[model samples]
Target chain A: MVKNKIKTVACLLLTLFFLGGCKKTFNQPQSNPEAVFNELWGFMDKHYPMFAIKEIDWDKTYAQYKNRVKPGMVDAELFSLLNQLLFTLKDGHVTLMSATDTATYLGFYKNYPLNFNLANIKNNYLFNDFKKAGPVMYKIVSNVAYIYYASFAQNISDAELDIFFNDIKATKGLIIDVRNNTGGNPANAEKFFSRLINQKTLVKYEVIKNGPGRNDFFEPKPFYISPNGQTYAKPIILLTNRLCFSTCNDFALYISLLPNAQIMGNPTGGGAGLPYNYILANGWKLQYSATYTLSPKMRNIENGIQPNRTINFEPQDENNGKDIILETAFNTLSLE
Target chain B: MIKYYSNKTVFLKIGLSLVCWLAVVNNACAQTLNPDLYKWTFTLGLGLNSNSVIDKNFSQLPYSGNGLGLSGSITYQGRLIQQQLNLTYGMATLQNKYYNSLYATYFTANYSPLFCLNNASNSAFKILAGPQIAMQYARRNYSGFVNNNSSFEFSTSLATSIEISYSIIPIGLVLKNKIAVPVFSYMQQPAFGFATFFANSGSQNSVKNSSDFLVPNKFYRIINNFTIDKQLAPRHKILLSYNLDFYKINTIREVKSIHNNLIVAYSYLL
Candidate 1:
């Protein structure tokens, strides 16, 4: 009986021990901001792909900025960090612009420029490189010149551009191809427009700067002039597509202002903005819109520069070997 | 009188022989039965309170106040595979003067396979491996001039763990060494993944400098434990355990080491 009693006591002790071991006490909860910062910093140190180019001392950066962050530093601080990080890419194509700003920029191109069609050669559209020798460039039997400007970047010198315009002035009609031009500088488009119009008129007004900063001024700029010492006087057609954007749309708009110019093809890509850069506390950089532009008549152009004569480039046209839009332009010019 | 006495002695001897035979048979039967062939153990544990960055950044600060944690588990043993199921529930309050308190809870299910190293004793050493699925729920409450607000969040996760354990019946004690590791889907951030991994890995030095943004500052501890369980009755058991967890944490925020922290818990099995 005594032995049995001892066994019972031993079992009781063991059960008590197990129950005690599992008992837990809760601790008070609180926010540790320094810990939070360190955690984030450590993750970026190990996982960020562009850590080398970013050239940031994560520890020091966090330590320095953590103190400055007071309570209620939520979305504003997050946006600042994102801006800093994206600026390191340094690509013009990469940027942040509000939807409203983008809309405003597109609206400036709608009323002024004309659009037209350019001939396709060897499956390549030639609007920006009409001078390049290939099956892409073919002079028609009517002595009409058809040019495709793929991009505004094709550096056609001012003198060479004038000579090309002079050569095409007497043709039955001119087809300025901008089907795929995304855009570059508005000045380039203005120069091309000058060759088609005789009137020296202000096509757009720009405010270079606001406030008491340097180079702040509001001025009207002459958009087009006859460079051959005479206007084309004949019908000039501008071609565009959805890929036509930025200064390319500006070109279409400016050219459309001429009495003899007509816009053909699809709508332009609506993106217009003058970008400015800002640096964040973390040494990251970001670019955003700083200004807006408008046509001379104060019309908004954010939606896109619409074509005067809407023509669809059908898939069947390619299979049938017919330049439907260009032929329509020619027939219209011939009637005139 | 002589005849009667002789008959009584024979009867006594016969009874003695029968009793001895029964004892031998019982001993043999006990020896033949394998203890390792089948085992069922139930465990209950409680964890101390903690806070995380997700709680701090998205939710209000002091996301959890002093709170209690509860967990229970059942395991089955086979020659090569051991199956286990676990359930856990925890609640904490967010204690702050300015912000209102918050509550959080989690539930998990796990399946593990056991690998035995020896077949010699009823008490043997085994390794366990398996995956676990978990669901978490959280709630927040606010008061004062800023206006009262309450919100709840739900999430699901998967985890894996490896554990080594020894059961010895002579001393009526069982010792366990366990490690847990977790892998997360890409939709979740890597910081959270690292935290989950470290929380289960049971590695003190491995995750000392780990940048798991989601883990609370107080959780950076490596837990090493020694446990003693004694069977009180046929179905009742008592357990006594002590654990030392290493924590190394920012001292400026709280007067504590950021690593090598320690916590102790005790439980009874029914």
Candidate 2:
């Protein structure tokens, strides 16, 4: 009995010596202009994926912007200055989402032809005949399935992909139009392209920023596109425009790699960079890419991916009420 | 290796102190001590908690938020040794209002030994020290065009606590105060941003380093708690408590969180 009691005492003492112990801090941060600007600028300097690739001198960019940032600047002026900094990166994925406004870089299409018009397509091609599933719109034209995917972010359910493809399986070929599809989920890009390839294909390589230093990046890791559970052998004509970016850019590049695929129209707005957002000390939010994405050829897609056959739909063709991109895709696939 | 050696030294020193105390109690002829006379008490509590996140990843000063949480503990009180052993578990979920659509949840399990200054049934002062392991998971859900951003972290802390209790049996009122501080911790935080974690077949590189622990100057947690018990019978009581917890770390970036809680509980002593 005494031995048992001593053992119990020792065990209790030992247990006592070994024993132990994230959060919503809902309080608003003190808002300040200069501090917020520094947070935004510092984040990009350290993590933005395109500094070296774009030949941007960030320190010099900081010197120029910091001169414009005043401590007493209001929310609008601060937001304008910060948005201007992202605009300098010329990446569409670089966005500032705030209560009053959302900012994005549209320089990709500012100097280029739109290369796509919804009104023109609906009047000439779709003609109230297009079927909608998720972010995909489809219509049959001259024995071809013309499917328009408006955004890469829009998810296509397995059932939707199955039904949509099954409905159009008898067509002679496919025209996948992604013009004006700015971007969305990159996973969707891989998934949508996976439906075209029967085997696993390496679509893109990714390099992640590890440290705050401009050049600190892990070695490129290959991102693969696994077969998306469906197979099609018909030639696919993937259309593009300058506004197509990020995941959109990725999707166009992946399709362009397929043996039976052809890419036509303007080069995409390069947004292959993956953007993440952070709130400033003043609760203003800033968005910028931290992950650098590259094409299968190891070319940085931030400068946009060039199409195999760059075709501009002439304004005269649109004035005559014609969908020139669609007409070109139909004519090209009709020949195949 | 340094942590292993220093913690071992701490165990040895405390073990020696306990053995000496046992020796003194055993030699006291006027008092007889029995280990079988120890009593166990269990309490279950639900709390309304308010908190703030100070992660540099979020904002300069993370906004304050509120949450509901549950806590329960099993305590063994030694009448002869004038000591107690407590094992506790607690969890809470909080939302960041300023950064709308973001949620953070925390889970912690703690074991601590209390050395009473007086007899267990009549003690007013106690000292406590122990180790705690904790984990946190946070999510910033879909906002505008971006969706499903999340993060997870794990850490271990060495905590020391001081507790005081006052009881007036005739008035059926009992009050207790405890303050605990974690002097050091080793923590692991994800290197890449949550948005970079792709939703489909997303790949991540996980690297383990003692960098947070090696820095030595980065992390801390302080907890203050107050409890009041109103007894209706010898075996049953109503308990109310307020807990204030504050934590800060600067591993990859500066992150801080604070929680204030008001708890109501039912107590059972056996």
Candidate 3:
């Protein structure tokens, strides 16, 4: 009986282990004005990708914005303050999403001269009945295969590439128009780049944030594309505009690197950095760049990547059903 | 070397429950035991578990309150090992307010071969040790965040259970207290911020991080349930139980979870 009693005591002692380990936890942050501001500040200090190149003083920015925050203010009021802080990053990808709304910087394209009037091309060039080959919209223009790839969001299959290029294989050259593409998956850009290069090419490099420290980074890694056995040897002209962001910017930089390809039009609206999301206490999600990408020459293209030739259309030229940029690419492609 | 700190509040609550249990057992006297027994128990419980994040990856701050936890278990006792063998199948959930939750479905086989007396129905004390294997699925999703992700975990643990049971009447009432803890466990954690549920080599974007289903010394778990069963008929009984279950996993970050439940169930003894 005594031995049995000893066993009972042991079980109770073991049960005590559970009550001894509790600690404080937080799944959601409280709605404190100060806490929300601090979270935003901390998140940016740790996650923003382009601080090194943008040359903004984050500490000074924090001190300036911290003074504007106040208690009993609505989310919208606080969001305005955060928007101002984010705008200081000069990043086109940094964005704040609240319960009811979203705010981001379109500064790259906004207030800049517009390019690529699609309606003019549809009515005057492709004539509204351009063959819809898979996800690409294309037509033959003046003996050149004019293929307009609108967005990388649209998947491009190798079979579709074969069909499209095969149709234009007999033409003088190829005009690949990706004008207003705000970007999507970079893999699509790789797939499209693969068809142009006969050998592997290192187009860009990337470095993602590794730690909470503002300076933390993984050593930059090379991003490359391999040659597709079947290649397009004809002269390739890539069209661009200020509205080209993200993958569009990446694509323009890459396609222009090809020996046979040339980039024409205005500078690209650069968002070469990759964006990631974080959840706020109020269930709002704020997005900021977490990865930094570089051009082949190790140039920071966060603000904008320049084209080989900068050209603009005139009013008289457009009134005559001629886009000066497209005509230039057409003339260049036909001559080459 | 990494520094580790367990939650302070958790120690207080578990410590208090331990004191309360000690108080109750001390007041009760020993009773008779049955030498022959064969039975099956099915239990369902609902309770709240205050869970805090594990390790230094998360902020070490006080949590607001407890989250709702639920569990269901089935056990069978038969003459298999030394005196008795018990096999249990259980499923448990530990959820927090941040839209993060953990679910574990498990199978445990334990043999209580050594008793203060025998493996009979009327044994005063029993010590059981065996393996508890479980598949754990965890999810954390806050839509706007870029790194919000989910994972599926597989683990094996060596479980120890100390059980004390007493019968006050001929065969009418029985109170049982069991404290079970997995001394150490190894779990398979998915790669940080990567999903491998359907990972395969194809068009691209396939990095196989779910390579190992067994990793060493990556997990720990604990559960203690105290139950009182009162016989209603020859083969029927009413059971009331209170249980606490906790789980932790550490790789890049810690996945700490807790479950507590007060269970009332109808048990049929065969």
Candidate 4:
């Protein structure tokens, strides 16, 4: 009886060993052109939070673009058709990426004046003698600190900021020029903002899509920045332009909440939505704004944030090897 | 040969040689080495793992790929009980139908105790049953998705385990098969479109909110291991093992993952 039981047990284990671990395969969406188009449209319809904000009738967009995507259409034709479909949103945050190329809307900053001239600033203001701390390029121009922050993508560590603030202790005021900063990591901007605030300050509000309904959204949640690193409480002028976008826009908005800071230059290139990405069945990636952001006054600041004072760049002044925006920031600091 | 030694001295040498030869023969044929003397063992393994995952929250298509990794274990083998602790880490890639790949990494630790059913018997076959506790953390990342590209899970499971081993005396080999099924688990999976803000929130509650206790119907896991052991010396062994793990979570968005591994290891008996 013991031998029989052992034989049975061995056979049962062998059977189980052979029978297990079958790979599961899920039905993939068809790789046809029309099917790809429908997948893209359906995802955007369900998850894209800015269709209502951008005043787009997605069903009408589907009606207009659906016929353009045929079953036998090639990849290039399908890509172009999808590009046209995405263009109606007029959002800088939206993009379509394939193996060969990436397509995005540049009208946010392209149609406006190129308010920033790097060569002019480099030649005259932030000359070769300027000092670098993290992503910040700084030099005292006429006793006022000129901090030319080109992009928010580069990190400014707390230690680097401490060194930067200590170096500029003798300066009368600071000019923070974020003219062409298209945006990078928001945490970097938050870290930079933390130096200007003494207490926890509510900077903006954000709402996310929770349901598939066109109007479905979570209540706007408050975003705050608290004190961190070395505090610089001196008069600071934040310069902006049409090219300042994403976290650059966020930086400008946060600086406006500080009593010692003033925003100069044109309205910001607004891209307030938090972008999210999805992959289509054909391996193409589609990114769109998935959340809405509001200014402190509960106003829609997606188009752009208005500056406290408007400053413009001058080509004539560029011919003289000077950036008029920097001069304007200097004059504003002098008044302070 | 020569009269160099007296007959008495020669006889003494001859008697001593005979006794030594007989002792050697008796020791060689005895086969009475006690395993209980060497109860503790340490094993180090190198393996390759192939995985297939279908996470509807991340994507509808299944991502399948393989990777190479290493594992280490410590085991105690008493006369009628065995216990082991195993730790493993591996990195792999999961590719969709369109050839897009997501980077996957995983770490696991498991502890099991088995009681021998027929340890007192002289039969070469043995059966053991016990419980296993396993904890695992896995994460998948894709660079293409800017904000919601990463997804991760942490699970602690209690499982029923059984092992069967048979010794082939002629070849001096032992073959063992073990299987386990998780009865219940505490698992955490993020909500749809796992937000980047929550990842940087630095709040423990955010992690707790995504966790829940799950039963068999909602969370199912199974593990099967087959191994061949050869005793190279009284204090050494070489093992070849194959292990399979299958896990699935049924929620608003269902996710299923399977791992197939083949390992070669060396065990040192102490």
Q: What lDDT would each prediction earn against the true structure?
A: 0.45, 0.68, 0.63, 0.78
| DockQ (0 to 1) for model 4 | 0.15
lDDT of 4 by residue, B131-215 (tens): 8998888888875667677777788999889888787656668778888888989987765434523422311222112567888
Q: Better model by DockQ, 2 or 3?
A: 2
Model 1 lDDT tens row, A1-336: 645644554564445434433433223333343343344344333323222223545556666666754555554454444334334432222343322221122223344333332333433333334354221233433666776666765545567666666667668877777766877645566566666766666565332222222233234222323343556667778877666776676677677677778888777764433433322222122233333345667654433577898887567676565566666766776666
Ranking by DockQ: 2, 4, 3, 1
Off by over 4 Å in 3: A1-28, A157-159, A227-229, A315-321, B1-256, B259-270
Model 2 Cα displacement at B162 (Å)? 3.5
Question: DockQ numbers for every candidate?
Answer: 0.01, 0.23, 0.14, 0.15
Q: Which is better, 1 or 4, measured by TM-score?
A: 4
Q: Report the lDDT tens digits of candidate 2 across residue range A1-336.
A: 645643554454334322311233445554678777777887677668678898988888898988898878878888899898878887776788678898888787899998788888887778877888777889887889999888876777778888788888888899998998988877677667777898888888878766667777777778777776658879998889998887888888888789998888889888777767676666556777767778788988887888888888788987887777778889988887
Provide the TM-score for each candidate, comma-separated: 0.35, 0.83, 0.71, 0.77
RMSD of each: 23.8, 7.1, 9.0, 15.3
Model 2 docking category: incorrect
Model 2 lDDT per residue over B1-270, tens place: 444458889899999997887554444411322233326778888888776665665455455556687877676655333333333333444344554544656665555555543343322222333333333333323343243155545566666766655555467876666666766666766664433244435333323222366223677776666777898777788898876666677665567776677789888878
lDDT of 4 at B192: 41
What is candidate 4's TM-score for chain B alone?
0.81
TM-score preference between candidates 3 and 4, better one: 4
Reference contacts preserved by each model: 0.00, 0.42, 0.18, 0.25
Off by over 4 Å in 2: A1-30, B1-38, B79-101, B117-145, B169-172, B183-186, B195-197, B200-216
